[model samples]
Target: MATAYVDYFPLYIQTGIEAGLLDPELATFDLARLAAAIKPERDLDFAFLGLQTLYDRYLLHIDKTRFELPQAFFLRVAMGISLKEENREERALEFYELLSSFRFMSSTPTLFNSGTTRPQLSSCFLTTVDDDLSGIFAGIRNNALLAKYSGGLGNDWTPVRGIGAKIRGTNGESQGVVPFLKIANDTAVAVNQGGKRKGAVCAYLETWHMDIEEFLDLRKNTGDERRRTHDMNTANWVPDLFLQRVEAGGDWTLFSPDEVPDLHDLYGAAFATAYESYERAADRGEIRVFRRVKAVDLWRRMLTVLFETGHPWITFKDACNLRSPQQHDGVVHSSNLCTEITLNTTVDETAVCNLGSVNLVAHLTGTGLTAAGLDGELLRDTVKTAVRMLDNVIDVNFYTTPESERANQRHRPVGLGLMGFADALFALRIPYSSDAAVAFADSSMEQISYHAIEASSDLAAERGRYQTYDGSLWSQGILPIDSLELLRQARNGDLTVDTGKELDWDVLRVKVLRDGMRNSNVLAIAPTATISNICGVSQSIEPIYRNLFVKSNMSGEFTVANPYLVADLKARGLWDAVMVSDLKYHDGILSQIDRVPADLRELYATAFEMDPMWLIKAASRRQKWLDQAQSLNLYMSAPSGKALDELYRSAWRYGLKTTYYLRSQSATHVEKSTLQGTDGRLNAVPVAAAPVAATPTPAPVASPITTSAVPATPPAPAPEVPMDDSLLDAPAVCLIDDPDCEACQ
Candidate 1:
């Protein structure tokens, strides 16, 4: 394969250029040097899942030949992103080293089309819907075009008027945002995102919207089919005032956007004052259409719907806006599809963000994670190069809509996140549920945040500041750490975020204020669902889902075992056929394995085994350093309204800008099959013969998943069962399939 890649790469490029699949401006001699620079041996780095994913969706092919090898694929993406650099060859080589070495990777979109004929390298697009008929239809049209090029969509539907509102032009009542959302939902299903993936879109309605009740039912199976947007994701654009009202048991009023138009734009104390005045107007019979309900009732309903159908994910409007670096430019109506991106959207400009992630596992040195294990200098270099590559994506991209192009040029926002966080934790031997893990989350994010900001500032000195640099948070010398204060003030110090710092942020702040910033926002932690597979790492900051399980995806099922766990068990001479049987019997949990050491078991606890608060605590630490937000997914073994309420409220109190999903274990279990050997005694299956696992089983057998941070005592283990092929069919944990759209990878 390596020899074929080296010999046929030129022919592949030539054929691609002739077939209109590649850029025709290439010089043959330069391509020759790049092709030779490819180190085919690095292909060995790919795990089965990662390599299969690349082969299935990413590698450039002609007539299914798949002539482009792994090294060539990396070089192609590197060359594509660095086309505009002064020394293009040198820059491409730098990017190639970063990517091919598995130290950094561009998002899936960039990897898919970076050096192609039309490079649509952006991941997420945010658009604000207008109230008029033409504008609504136009927004739908924009969704089709953007999805055609594989961009995930986030539409702000807050501006559309609710049902029962007067429509003066037609002399009729407005049918509400739900009908239009139904149309948008169908559009996303129809597009299919360039035939590579499904068209993913999320509709965001403010908590104050009168249609909030109907919006919450969009994902329910028993809902009126026409009113339900079963294909679309929904989230509540919650303001701090609403949560405060819920806490105080105050009355919450819902109004149509047409009547309370300013509420869509106002946030923080301004929004609170305006909302109260509107309520007073309603009480005096001044406002046209308004409904009042107990705030606690509405809050409970929100949590109930979330637990039932998983729609309308809880997101904080005030926290997103208050912490936005582009606050001076515009309002952040909603987050992008995966809930990581928080950018400003307007009528003329659709927000665009190019994304990439650093491989946290790649930067670790030494056996145990001491201060000396982190290679800060190497990380700094990676950040600088990754930022430059992201910046170039804006200039070289093929925009699907005029609004997206406008936004990309003006703000030039980019998300630089990290993958392999869980893998890093495993390598360092840290338990995910421990305070040590939380501290690591804080410290690691602080370093990443510091370097990302400094890199953007350095870029500004070289490439000039972004067009909207002035009057922004960077111009005011307030970085992400400083922005937490703004959220604190907005919540009147009710916020519970730990404002800790480890880096010399003071020096970076001065440098940013002086040199400006190349992008409006940097450092958003996207889901990294697909890209992490390509890098053979854990997804962005997620805890280990299982120690062993089968992963099901488009390509088929593949068994994935934790290498770290296997190695540890092997070192202790406990990793034999019986141990494998024990693992499968317990459904990939180590806490119940008596033979495993307590420390190793603690280090390898699955996501559902730990209390959900551990996830929140670590996420809160990372959130403080992030400019935008992280795609936080909260897990609960048995979800209840109260548990859901406490978990989401803690997220808000901790100042999380947005959350992605509410994952819970189902009530059913995968039927256990019996395995017997020649002697009619039960025997363990070997790794080679492990069968595929079932999907969506109950949370592993143990104490039910908790919502509190206080650790609970481990549940007693069950008596040993006879091992058989049945054990091999254990439930696959974590993300077995692509949960989020690959656009944000």
Candidate 2:
């Protein structure tokens, strides 16, 4: 068969013209000429799986007919990014190169709706519902409108009266927040974004609310389906006081907002003091009714439901409020859909975030350095470029709802996140949980945060300060680094930094105060599921779930191994059938195998092998720098209620604004050989066995001593499992299968 090269630009123009979306006058630009500009050979770089993923989801289609090819998709995104540029064509081409070459990617919503007549370019939305009937329905209408425009919603339901609360207007008891949440849930289902994707919402409640327990159980499958909004997400807007109570093993008193007012507006020690006073009031019968439960017990139950149902994502009320650039404007009641965005959303305004991710792996120079071993200069440049790109996205994006537009324009919030962290770590041969690895995480993120703020400040010089920037911490010359003083205060029970290595915060703070900031909040770490796959990197900051597993991409199922792991083992002459069998026996853990060196074991520790505390700690360190929040997923093997309780409490103590997904391993591990019917045959013959000692319990590596300091020791190598094609090829879902799937996508 003869292969023919066809210019793809003309194809896109023709399709657009045929669909009546593109004007013939715009065709003055030669499609073939533009096509010549594209390197057709780049098309070959896409693996069958990557190509299929684009075809199935990324490509713009009209009724099963694809109008936008891969090249067209890149062009459209480029056009979207460069919509406001004076040198539009040049900027578009530059963006096209970055996108097509897989250097970076816009968020999925942008990919899905850009260049369309109605572009809903935002990723998340936050709204608040009023207590009155009309106001409540109005909130539902707002949710529907935002959802119709492809925005995820986070609703603050703390103001609504709880069950059995008095309704003055009706002169009767109220049905409380639960019934209203059910309506919100049904509405999310009813309006499904014109069938493009499920309508996503996260309902948030203050811990003081009486309906808190029921709210936490909404995601439980065993619960009354009517009371549950399994479709929507739930998060607890926890105050520091609650966490302190849990830590002190004190009692927690629950009260309706109607009875205990002003609790939502307080933070830190003030909030704790007020809460304790409220408990005393309730005990004295000053409050109508209340329930007292052991704080740890309540925390344990929260974890229990989370372990089973996967939600009520933990977000710190105090941290979110204290760090908010919009704090002077209003108290931020809750975060948006994915918990990465923390903005002030009220009855009048809905918070919006225009998000994009930098492909960290792309920054690695081709000097045979893996993504994990990215050159510092390359990483810094990528972050600087990405900060600029996200800033541009804020200006060029077309908002679907006025409230969202208003929120985004005033705050000018943008989330500059990362993808391929795991891949990068693998390339660097660094364990995700090691002190050295944590230092890298801290330094890299601090660099991004520092540069992102600097970039926004530069934009502020060009444009003007954000609408609400006047009274912000930025205006006070308080950089995110300066906020460390607050954290040190919280950590040490007083404001003092005993730790050495003074950050260059004073300088950055001075610079920020002088220049102002273009955006109110500049940095957030989102779970870049689809974008990561597009860049062929690991998802977000998560570790690899397995070295070898079956990833069902759009093309079909294929086995994907950690390329770095495979290459390293191949170099060691240990890539063989027996090693594969060991991996199977160990459930993808490599530490127990004696053949694997200590260095590799430390470097290649799977998510389960790495302690949950390490994940929380790393996120905490990064959180100190981030103005908004992070999509930090905590992984645990055989997780208990107590384990989860401690994990979340620790997160709260560390002042993390938000926590995203809580993924736990099932108790029973499915031996791959048993599933594939090869177990008996594989184990029938006894091979030469290394006398292996019992697996040692991995200790939590201490936090990095300094922001820029490197650890003294390199990560130990993970033990080698004898390789078997069958075991290595175990089947699992690829992240791109459903780009809109809530789990990974």
Candidate 3:
């Protein structure tokens, strides 16, 4: 493997440059030295799914044959990102080590275009659509161009007037935001992200809009075909006032932006005041094209629509704006496609964010939690370098639109997050639903937050602060933790999130104030759908979906087994054909297996098997450290309206800025025909047994196991049934088909 890479690297570089795929400057590198640094053995680290994904879409290929192997691919990306550095070769090597060793990984776009001629390294972009026709078309056109270069998008549509609003120039009623959204959806479909991936865009509408009900129905299959935006993602830009009204069971009024234009920019108390005043105007018959409805009724409808069709994700407007570090600069109208990026978007300035993640599994010091389990020094060094690489992307990136270029240059935001949280937990022997897990979430994020802030401050000391740094929260010496006070004040002391700190944040605060900050925003947690696969780790901040399942993707199907569970079983002499059959019989759920140890069952409990409130609690801990937001997905095996109400309310009370997909247990079961030697046979499962409901509280850990046993002989082969291809097509734990899922990495 080593010899193959060493000999072919120079030739690959030559072919790439000749084909105009690679940067011309790459030809000047010491090809021999770079090739010699390639550690082909790291290729062994890849699971089948990871390697297949790389080969299918990531690796640089010529004539449909991959010329760049895994290590070479990492080196190529590192070299592309480090091309402008003073010691470009050294920096490239350092970055290569991080990538190949699975210590850090950049977003999909950065990996795709990093070493290429057009390095469109930014992952996500946000643009606010103006109410006017020209401005709306401009925003749509910008979407096409941005998506053409493989960037995910979020468009704030609150400024556009709702249906029944008067159009003064034409002296007619407007058809509403839905029709324009239809055109935007078509544009995204047409672009298709340069044919590499689906062109994805999310449309956000404020809850107070008169067309709010119609916006909520965009993804429903029952709606009029012409009125629905089936191709585009939708999110409700919910204000705290709406929730307050819902809780109060009071009436809520809607308005057209033309009549209430400033509502798009207002948030928190100002929004509440203006909204209430508008309600009174509607009651007094002073406002036109306004409607009134019970807030509770509307809230129930929102949840019902959400359960029926997974659209119009619930995202809080006030939590996003109130806790924003750039609150002094502008208001955050909405989050990006993944709901992880909360930034100010305007007609003149489109928001752009560069993203990357550190592999948490690489920073651990032992297999189980110790007093000093996480290597603080190693994480600090990794974050420092990762931040530098992300910062370099802004200078070297190929911007498709001038608006994106403008916003990126002025604020220079970078999201340095993490992956492999579940894997790290497994290594630490901590159950996902336990208090120890929540505590680790807090400490780990606190450490990442501390280092990311300090890293930006270090960059500011050397390279000067961002152009708009003076008016930001850093200028006021308020970090993400300290900014919670702003949210508390905005919510009138109703907020209920923990603000405990383990690190000496004041020292970092003093450093930030003294040196200013290189980036306006430093942290966000994107759903690392594909990159986590490349690293062979669990998805970003997600619980284990299953112990064993076949994952399907663009690369094809591959079996994913929990290696940690397998190792523990093998140690206890429980690994056998019977165990595989048992897993298949229960659809990879270990809790039902009588032969498996109770402690192991708790440790390996799948996502749906555990109470989802634990996910919320863990996210709340992480949210306090994240400056932007997190792409948090809640999983429920059995869902109810009441449970959803309590869960989302907990999210808001915990000060969560945004939420992502709400995954429910699929009715389909994995086929058991693929087991070795068993043919079509499956281990006997109790016919009357039913799945346990995931209660909203943590359950105590099971007692440790002393002994376990498996049957001496496997069950005989049984009659085969016709195969269902749908089972093969079902999404794996990590790779949901949502277009925005992996776009932000």
lDDT of 3 at 149: 83
Please give, for residues 1-745, the per-residue lDDT of candidate 1 as tens digits: 6567768778877877887788875543387777778888888888778889999888878787776778878988888888888888888899999999888999988998988988999999999999999999999999999988889999999999999999999899998999999999999999987778889999999999999999988987775798998888899999999988877768999999899889999999999999999999999999999999988778877777776676688998999999999999999999999899999999899999999999887887553322123578888899989999999999999998999999999999999999888877776656788776787788788888899999999999998999999999899999999999998887778777888787888899899988999999999998888888888788888887777766665666665667777766766677677777777677678888899987778778887888788888889899999989998887777555555666778888878888877766642221234424422112323443332211111111221112233256322121221222221222223233554456688
| lDDT of every predicted structure (CA atoms) | 0.81, 0.68, 0.83
lDDT of 3 by residue, 1-745 (tens): 7898889889889988988789988988988999999999888887667878999888877778777778888999999999889998899999999899888899999999998999999999999999999999999999999998889999999999999999999999999999999999999999987678889999999999999999998887775989888788899999999988888778888899999888889998898888888878878888888988988778777776676677788999999998899988888998999999999888999999999999887887732322126889999999999999999999999999999999999999999888999877777667788777877889899999899999999999999999999889899999999889999998889877888888998889899999999999999998888898898888889898887776666676565667777666766777666777788888889988999989789788998987777888888899999899999988877666666677777788888999988777763356677654543233222112211110101222221211223223222211221222222222223224444576788
The C-alpha RMSD of each candidate to the native structure, in angstroms, is 7.0, 7.8, 8.2
lDDT of 2 by residue, 1-745 (tens): 0122245566676677677654443354444545566655667556444566678776766677877767777777666666666666676676777777766677777776665555666788888777778878888888898888667788999988788888888789987789889999999989886466678788999887899999988876676788888778899898877766666768888888877777876777677778889988987888875788887767766666666667787887877887777778888899877788888887788888878776665665433332324455765655555566667777767676677778888888888877777765555555687665666667667767777888888878877788889988899887766666665564455221212223476677777888899888888888876566666677788788775555553345544445556556656776566676666677657788899877667777888777777777677677878888888877766565445555666666556788877765542342464433443213312223211111111222222232332345332222221222222121221122222323213
Error of 1 at 731 (Å): 17
Count clashing pairs, candidate 1: 1
Model 2 TM-score?
Answer: 0.85
Q: Report the alpha-carbon TM-score of model 3 versus the true structure.
A: 0.92
* lDDT for 350 (candidate 3): 97
* Best-first order by lDDT: 3, 1, 2
lDDT over C-alpha atoms for residue 471 of model 1: 97
lDDT of 3: 0.83
Name the better of 1 and 2 by TM-score: 1
